[model samples]
Target: MFKVIAVAGSPRREGNSATLLKAALAGATAAGAQAEVVYLNDLSFRGCQGCQPCTADDTCRVQDELTPVLGRLRQADVWLLGAPIYFDGVSGQMKLFFDRLHHLTNEAGQLRKMLPGRRAAAIVVTYEDKPRDDYREVAQRLANYLGWMGRFDPVEVVSLGRLGPSDAAAARPELLAEARALGQRLVEQLAQQGRTDG
Candidate 1:
């Protein structure tokens, strides 16, 4: 029963998305969460072919990088998906992975039982020049999609946007505080469940 599963959906290993996610994951770990981080860039996977085999077999027929990772994701009590926004949306790699999850969704279009009874959270980091809610639009849509397919609405959505190297350099204390808070929130939720499932 792992407490939380953190997915780093950035193509670049050391990209901003991964960096911020690490901060969040560090927080979760400090709060006593047994967290495993999956770096999607290291996995070899293709976009979903739209075949309905998983519906019949209750598993994806096209096995590749996602087979084991999806299993880990299914067993997790909380899923923390972190991705960078590109061109006003999630990165291509992240979108491909989510699209592949279609195979695991029930015929009625709900998330399969494998992912039921869990909570999801989205951590999106962007360097958008504008300070508007542009990132929130995409983040909420992602959270909504997860709610529909994963059967678990998000308990929280954290956005670290408009940040530059300067922020990380000049405001380390504030950044660390946010990271700790994120971690504490994740662990508190899992502890509320009284145990880990994945």
Candidate 2:
């Protein structure tokens, strides 16, 4: 079975981003893939300290909640990142998660990456504003960083906008469908690559 790691980067419980992430994980299961969702809000971890201890083997030395999670991330075939936009950028939790991923890069300035093998990833972002290019940089930069880590181009970027309590992405059928499609596509791509570990 292919394993997918879905990350919910929202601080709010049952928030729009988390809801869509769960939907995507459901779709992955329907596609014959095993998936796990990790909620950043529930974890007790700190941002990277730039200690460079991972330089020896690319293992973060923080020894917090994120340590084991990062280990699982390295073993997964696919990754799904879900976050909410805050002030035209990704949520603070999401930023911290990404910051901790510096272990994937062996050298400063991304000259060398230690993470072995390429994996597929999808990005989901929920925003309160209308869909615009201004907020796209965050996701795009994430994709670029994953590329630097030897991961495949981000399989999808789902940006849901005009979101409020009543207009949550989960409540929007079209957006939910998009989330499911993203998951299905990720599994299909993994199958095509013969990446199933089971």
Give the lDDT of residue 10 in candidate 2. Answer: 90
Over 4 Å off, model 2? 107-110, 196-198
Among the numbered candidates, top lDDT falls to 2
**Candidate 2 lDDT (Cα, 0 to 1):** 0.81
Q: For model 1, what is the error of residue 33's alpha carbon versus the real structure, in angstroms, after optimal superposition?
A: 1.3
Error of 1 at 96 (Å): 0.8
TM-score of each: 0.82, 0.92
* Candidate 2 local lDDT, 105-145, one digit each (tens): 77654357665655689888888888877667678778778
Candidate 1 yields a Cα-based lDDT of 0.67
RMSD, each candidate, Å?
Answer: 3.2, 2.5
Residue-level error in angstroms, candidate 2, position 17: 0.8
Model 2 reaches what TM-score against the true structure? 0.92
Q: Whose TM-score is greatest here? A: 2
Those runs of model 1 whose alpha carbons end farther than 4 Å from true positions after fitting are 108-114, 151-154, 164-172, 193-198
